[model samples]
Target chain A: MRLAEAWRVALDALRANRLRSMLTMLGVIIGVAAVVALVAIGTGTKQQIENQVEGLGSNLLLVVPGRIQAGSAPTSSPLTLDDIDAINRVVGDRSRVAVTIASGETVRAGSRTGFASMQGVLETTPTVFVRNLDRGSYLTRTDVSTGRRVAVLGAGLARTLFADRDPIGRQITIGGVRFRVIGVFEPLGQSLGVDRDGEVHVPVTAAQRLLGTERIDGIAIRAPDRDRIGDLSTAVVAALTDRHPDTDFSAVTQEQILGVLGDILGVLTGVLAAIAGISLLVGGVGVSNIMLVSVRERTKEIGLRKAVGARPRDIGLQFLLEAVLLTTTGGILGMLLGGGTALLVDRLSPVPAALTWWSMALAFGVSAAVGIIFGVVPAQRAGRLDPVVALRTE
Target chain B: MTAAIVADDVSRTYQLDGVSVPALRGVSLTVDPGDYVAIVGTSGSGKSTLMHLLGGLDRPTGGTLLIGGRDVSTLSPDEMAALRNTTIGFVFQSFHLLARTTAQDNVGLPLVYRGVGRRERRERAATMLERVGLAHRITHRPNQMSGGEQQRVAIARALVTGPSVLLADEPTGNLDSATGQSVLALLESLVDDGVAVVLVTHDRDVAARARRQIVMKDGLISETR
Candidate 1:
């Protein structure tokens, strides 16, 4: 028989038992949908994290004391301004090197008070990082050199302390010491789970005096070009290691961070797809069972067809076609459903989701395979039926 | 021209739970085009077995059976099916029409195996249905039709491929006497068109109407007249 006729016959058979066909298809529908939606969510999160990591800065490297591997302890040798000067000499550009010493402190302006993360930074912070000023000027070299008490309020902190009033040149007390605000930074929502707009920046020298600490948290360096980042990292890590021979310094780039994070998220996506595949397996079993029942029910029909002229091959082809048709239809519906769910999630929720063509293709391919794998035994049984015996069935 | 079907000393022994039981023991028969013959017997007397063998649904285990001049033992299962498609048509006692399909599609089924195109198959099926006096009921499913009409539809389905031989097994058994007469008349009408008609029946009245009769006793033919 022609393939088209086989398909028509299969379709007619399915239509004859529309309710049973639909119920049998439901399992595959849910399985394919779950795979598409879950994979979308996983990939979307990976993309979101990548964007945030890249948003930190271009051609940037973060140097932290001690190894950044799992279960590593902090080094006893803290990063000092002398170490910064040593790195500055090697880098040949003072503006590309910056460091920060962080402390959480409460600030007061008049009767208003708010807690904020206080970051002691140098004049070169704005150049080394991606921060932009909304009003007034950022810290100057003279401010850091003279130990002048000056601060830059973040967008959120400025709103809290001064509200409608201008925050630049306003006085705010930090740890019982007063400093004049020199600038207000533009709003930066969040990056790497840190609230950028909730920080207050001060001159490192003045901050050291207020906090009574000389230890620095970390160093940020901007390479001259993208390709030089690796070379520059090696140089800076060597310089820091030279000063503190007992400690190991690690310089991490954005790509390294993204690679590690992408690995974790990729595994998570695979696991979710695997879990969804279990349901597809179950659906395939259901298809096999239903097809067996259909074969049993149509034994007399098989006998009649054989008596008329149908070959065993034709009978087998018809049944196999029926199974493939069932699953492929279910697969298509599930794709629409999964794509719709992904679209809905992307729009209505904070959790990101994106559908890829490959995932859709994979789900479709698997569904068709499910049909073939589950269809074989029943189709063979129908083909191998003894016509005389089958005709004897009522 | 070759006979439509020729069986020479054919025998069929079936295995039931590893024990052999002979259904047809050395029965020989010859049917020519335009012939009308009937095989009559009580249940389990091997008339059905002979019909099945002549239809090419089962091969004879002993002796030679030729359908369309090809020996039954020489044909593969697929070749046997192809021979049946081109040379033989079947009508069952219970009207074995697909329950959910229209009369037209059910009639077109044999052509489907012959690789006939859909449109041509439908046209031929309609023509055959009309020939069986079911022109107005072409679209009706079997369940919607009366017993007589369903048997006519089955006759239409059997004859749709324009085969050389038509095999009817108790074709009128399920119908009322009046309806059975009409169905039997339809089968007789096809023999005039040079198609051999072979009928298996237990009804003496039905057997009397045929041009030839073979009565079987046990697994062998007891009489031919």
Candidate 2:
């Protein structure tokens, strides 16, 4: 028989048992939808991380003491202010260099107390990183030279300590030492999993005296241009290594961090798709089971068709087409459902979700393959039935 | 003209549980165009088996059985199916019309296997339904029609392929006497149009109306007239 005619007969058969057909398709629907939505969420998280990393600052490089490879415990930093001055000479632009000595400390203005990430930094911090002040002036050369007890409060910390009152020029104590708030930073939300607006910046000199430590945690440098980052990183690492012959320093660019993160998330997306594909496998089994029942139920009809000169292949083709029709239609509905869910989650939540074309195509192709793989046995059974015996069945 | 079907010393043996059961043993028969032949037998008399062989639904285990001059034993299953499509039509006692299908679509089924297009299949089915006096009932499903009308639809389906032979296995078995008479009259009318008619029946009166009679006893023909 012609394929079109076979398709019509298959469609007619499915329509005859509407509820059963729909129930059979449900398994496939859930499977495809899960695959699409999960993959979208995974991809979106990866993209979000990439954006935050790039948004840190253009042509940025971070130099940290000790090795940065996996499974290594952090060693005590030997980096000092002298190392920063030496690296400043190598970059030829002192404004491009910055350093931080980070400590968790509690700060208080009157009875209002708030915990903040205390970032001991130089005046060049705003120039090296993407940060801005909302009010008052930032620290200057004399602040680090003379160890001035002046501070800048993060936007969230400023709000918590002073409420509506102006925070600039107010007295706050960090690590139980009295300091004046010289400026309040603009509101910068979470980036690279850190709350930028909940930090306090002071001169490295005062932070060392207060915390009783001369070592710096890390160094940040902004390249003059994107192309100069490689040369600048080599120079900074060499300069730091020259000072501390017994210590190791690694200088990493933003792109390397993104690449590693992207690799990890890519695998995560694939794993999610694979887990969802298990449901599709179960759905295929359901299709096969229903098709078997249909074949058994329509034994006499099969006999009739065979008697009417339908070839064995024709009978097999009809049943196979019915199975494919069920899954393909189910796949389309699942795509819409999944796409809608991804869209809703993207719009309504902070969790990122991006629907990729390849994921949709992969889901669709796998569902179709599921139909064919499970459809073969039942169609064969129908084709191989003895016409005389089948016709005798009630 | 070639006989529509010819069987010479044909035998059919069925295997059941590793034991051979002979359904038709060394039986021979011939049916010609415009002939009306009725086969009468009780259950297990092999008349049904003989009919199945003549319709090309099964091959005889021994000897030659030909439908439309093609030897059944030599033909593959698919080739036999093709031959049956071109040369034979069948009407069952139960009026095995597809339920929930209109009379026109039911009648067009055989043509579908013949690879006929939908428009032409519909046109031909409608014409054949009219020939069976079911023209007015063309749109009615089998469940919506009376037994006699459903049988008429089956008959229309059988004849739609323009086969040379019509095989009816107790075509009127499910109908009332009046309705059975009308359906029998429809089969007899096809003989007048030069088609060969072969029927298997248990009713003696139904057997008596045919131009020729063959009475089967056991697995072989016991008498013929």
Q: All candidates' lDDT scores? A: 0.91, 0.92
- Tens digit per residue, CA lDDT, model 1, A215-333: 78799998999899989999999888888888788999988998998999899999999999899889989999999999999999999998888899999999999999888898999
TM-score of each: 0.95, 0.97
Please give the C-alpha DockQ score of model 2.
Answer: 0.77
Per-residue accuracy of model 1 over B1-225 as CA lDDT, tens digit each: 889899999999998999999999999999999999999999999999999999999999899999989998999999999999989999999999999899999999999998899899999999998999999998999889999999999999888888999999999889999999999998999999999999999999999999999999898999998
Q: Write one digit per residue (lDDT tens) for candidate 2, span A1-394.
A: 9999999999999999999999999999988999999999999999899888987788899999988999999889999898888998999888999999999999989999999999889999988888889999898989988999999989999999999999988999998999999999999889878998899999999999999989999999999888999999988898888889999999999989988889999899889989998998899999999999999999999988888898899999999999999988888888888888998999999989999999899888988888887888999999988888788889
lDDT of 1: 0.91
lDDT of 1 at A313: 90
Tell me how each candidate scores on DockQ against the true complex. 0.86, 0.77
Error of 2 at B97 (Å): 1.5
What lDDT is reached at residue A362 by model 2? 88
For residue A45, give model 1's deviation from the true position in Å.
Answer: 0.2
Best by TM-score: 2
What residue runs in model 2 are displaced by over 4 Å at the alpha carbon?
Answer: A134-137
